[model samples]
Target: MSTPTSTTAWVHKTTIKPTEKFIETLQKQDLPLPTLGPKDVLVRLHAASFNYRDILIPRDQYPFPVNWPLVPMSDGAGEIVAVGPQVKSFAAGDNVMTVFNQEHQAGRHSIVSATSGLGGALHGVLREYAVFPEYGVMKSPKGWTHEQAATLPCAAVTAWNALKDIKAGQSVLVQGTGGVSLFALQFAKAMGAFVVATTSSKAKEEQVKALGADVVINYNETPKWGEVAKKASPRGEGIDVVVEIGGTATLQESFRAVRMEGTIAIIGYRAGPTKDGEKEPGWGEILGSICQMRAIFVGSRAIAEEMVSAIEVAGLKPVVDPKTWTFDEAPQALDWFEQGRHVGKVVIKI
Candidate 1:
């Protein structure tokens, strides 16, 4: 196959405001293909997945600084169209997915090693063609669709990192029906754990149950749902793990819901900012929980490879929202994601 000379991309020009229109900040551009380095492989992206973080990119809400005219998306899967002379692990026609952190291959993460994250400090995978170091991408899981493979990079990897050590029979509490939470539900069930999920929507309670959740709680109905969750645990010992995605708004509840010496994986702050005049949970409460609190920043490529192997072995499929958008409808996809109406993942077909 012949390589294209130019490809289209959605470029974020300035910091977006919550009140401002999302499409206004991002504009389409047809640019020359990026130059390939000695250890690079140019991929022709077939599909890209959206995360909550993708919406934050335009607003510059991500923890990292923005790279101007950024192609803003972390999860994408495609076929390798060309490879540099020094590239040996990948070749033409290899199907692969981009990694969230391009530099952190393995081991513990560091500020320096984590700086090269896609869609933040570095250019992301939104473009039709992107050049990546061979180490930055991994082969997609066997027998998976491009869209399914696309969802693995960010949400799936984060979920895998959170539940890598969880054994069967343990109880886990996952908040919301977002990508990470849904993936957590699936992964925890695969590990034989009892899953308890929280969603504000009563309509989604059955949906969460269908996803193998042993119990579902409507946090809106039960504002202090933590006590209820604790009671639902085996012998009322509290949960073994809490996928804490709500930050200050929900940390207090997590502390209340988790058992002694349990694990809390801090993933995202989708619960919005802390309300004015609202007090955060005191340190005494946090310390009293005595749980292992670890911050998750996606994960390494090695972990992604392991997750993909598990997916292939278990025949696990990502829960993609039925509403898919074309490349031209990228803006709509983002709008839908921002509305927070869909379950699982929202994908863009390239």
Candidate 2:
């Protein structure tokens, strides 16, 4: 792990260059120590994780919003080193995570802005230190490490928002063992909902089952995983919630599997629909016509607060493994995430 020097560190940072020459052009440049804003908290970062969005930024293909020469990541966890005078919710030494949308602190719909997000239009937390507004920070649950807490803001919170209204004894179907799906399974089980999970790899079937999934469907073995998911739910009652991470690849099947009025949280496009002979509908047609309601992104800060409370109340712990990499190994960590070998969240220790 990289250590801090002089209460500050020589941080190796990543940035985007418009030349499109090579990603290496965004090299390990030195950044001056990060400073706290009046209502901001300066966090001494221990670890940060990569999301699909992080991978897309370097390739110049990310769909959301961004700017160049930006440090690239939205999720991170660390101890609070200093808090501005007006901050009272958290103090120095508290382990906390910064919000995905820095500007939108509360409510159901977030007001998206270019300057608020990390790793795109604004500076991200790939460095040894990061400063965030106190309103965007949340104290991590007791007994969770910085690495584990780092995975919550993006994928995990999206899962929580997706199933927030689900009731006890209801059923949920998760697409695969990716970050959002796996987190959904654990959370849903703890909510007293029966879970049906799927995986292309047989090796991960038992692993999903052990995570409290009532049924694990090996999609490789059964091509129609939607049918399997239906059968697994009691009396073919169908799923009340579906954590839809496969995007176009599983959208049609998701439509078939979910009960009428059930909700699907569409989170990713990694597993595209055209692959494996799955048919994909045009987004314009599907958006207004097929699904009655759709949630495009994670909920607001108020939702994040509710999720933290539910997590504590249910004693739900996020599953994360530290993916430590020396300053030189950052590229390899990104490559591994691109290869999709991880069962849980992947983090880089700086």
* Tens digits of lDDT, candidate 2, 1-350: 34222232222234335543323444666666545667988888887787888777776667666766666678888998788889989888899987887776766553464246777666777777777788777888778878778888888878888888888999988877777888899888888998988888877887898898898888788867776676678768567787887777777767666766677777777775467644675676455333444665765677788888888888887766445664356666776787788877788776
User: What is the TM-score (0 to 1) of candidate 1?
Assistant: 0.97
Over 4 Å off, model 2: 1-26, 33-35, 110-115, 276-278, 281-291
Q: How well does model 1 score by local distance difference test?
A: 0.89
- Model 1: colliding residue pairs: none
* lDDT of each residue in 1-350, candidate 1, tens digit only: 67787889987886777787766667788978868888999999999999988877786678876778788898999999999999999989999999899998998898865888888888887789998899999999998889999999999999999999899999999999889999999999999999889998877898899899998999989978888999999869899989999988888888899999999899999997777866678888888888889899988988988999998888889999999999888877787789999999988999
- On TM-score, the candidate that comes out on top is 1
Best by lDDT: 1
TM-score, model 2 to reference: 0.87
Clashes of each: 0, 1
RMSD of 1: 1.3
* Distance from true location, Cα of 263 in model 1, Å: 1.3
